[model samples]
Target: MLNHFVRVTGLSQSAQMGALPASYAATSPNAQGGKYYGPDGVGNGALGGYPKLIDPHHNKVVADKSQWAKLWEISEKMTGVKFDI
Candidate 1:
């Protein structure tokens, strides 16, 4: 599932942005960490820290849409990739 997403997303990105700068594409992706929140919907409000996420409501940070949106904003600025979704 994860691999599929990466593949599809990569294809979509390529389709939209055309060929990526080889130098930039060759570097490690910036997926290390980002601002995150717990399942209880509380966070430090600062960006760039992956959450330990102990809240019972959510098993992982992926369930947090707000955080994802902010992360998406950061991603757009850094990668210059845009999507209609």
Candidate 2:
């Protein structure tokens, strides 16, 4: 898994986008906000990743840090891994 991550990190932005579903590719901002790929994935953005920063219940980004923490804790338990801050 780590090797795959490393390999993907080395890919150019267009190459990386080629592997994504249309919806995911579309969600990745261009000049509008911030692109979520390349060396600095999700640079200057809070809501980009494989699982993405979403609230399933609301079907949107979690609006508050406390709520995000709650979701993060649940995900940590499920995955048995804590994300790096």
Candidate 3:
């Protein structure tokens, strides 16, 4: 997931590390006009790994519906648990 994020965002690991403090600061209560932190921020830090895994821009899990179906098929075979997805 981290690799995917870095590739799509074109940010080096060090650059990502450098941005962490600012990300935390911006999500602070005072920085956000006293509202609680939310998932609407601009950078990936807003929602952490969730954005890395599920965000449309970063998601490379499957290219299209056929691949998605194939993934579920493999998973079901491995786990012996059918999924509705």
Candidate 4:
């Protein structure tokens, strides 16, 4: 699953935005122990510590909605389950 996500999104496999120890110090006050927190403090925040694709110019290149849809489609096909997304 991680492989597919990285491939589809063109994201780095092991270089995430907030995965470094230094990033923990920049966490929001609402975060618990410098970890991400979702609304209502239930689950991890969306895309926590997820790597982003960087261009040659050091600019961040994010996957568009179509790419996200493709990822969801691939996931559904692999899992044999339907996703509402």
Which lDDT tens digits does candidate 1 get at residues 1-85?
Answer: 8879867654223322322222223443642233322222124312212223232334466577787899999999899998778
TM-score winner between candidates 2 and 4: 2
TM-score of each: 0.28, 0.32, 0.30, 0.31
**Worst ten in a row by lDDT for model 2:** 44-53
Encode model 2's per-residue lDDT on 18-76: one tens digit a residue: 44533453565532233323222364222223323322244345446688889889999
How many Å off is the CA of 48 in candidate 1? 20
Q: lDDT per residue, candidate 3, 1-85, as tens digits?
A: 9999977885543546545545655654445333223233346454332111223335355346777778778989999998674
Q: After superposition, how far is residue 73 of candidate 2 from its true place, in Å?
A: 0.9
Best by lDDT: 3
Could you tell me the lDDT of residue 10 within candidate 1? 44
lDDT of each: 0.44, 0.48, 0.51, 0.45
Candidate 4 clashes between residue pairs 3 or more apart in a chain or in different chains: none
Q: Which regions in candidate 1 have their CA more than 4 angstroms from the true location?
A: 1-61
> Poorest 10 consecutive residues of model 3 by lDDT?
47-56
Q: CA shift at 79, candidate 3, in angstroms?
A: 0.4
TM-score ranking from best candidate downward: 2, 4, 3, 1
Candidate 2 clashes: the total is 0
Ranking by lDDT: 3, 2, 4, 1
Summarize candidate 4's per-residue lDDT along 9-72 as a digit string, tens digits.
7454345444542344355443345242222211222333432222322222333667667777
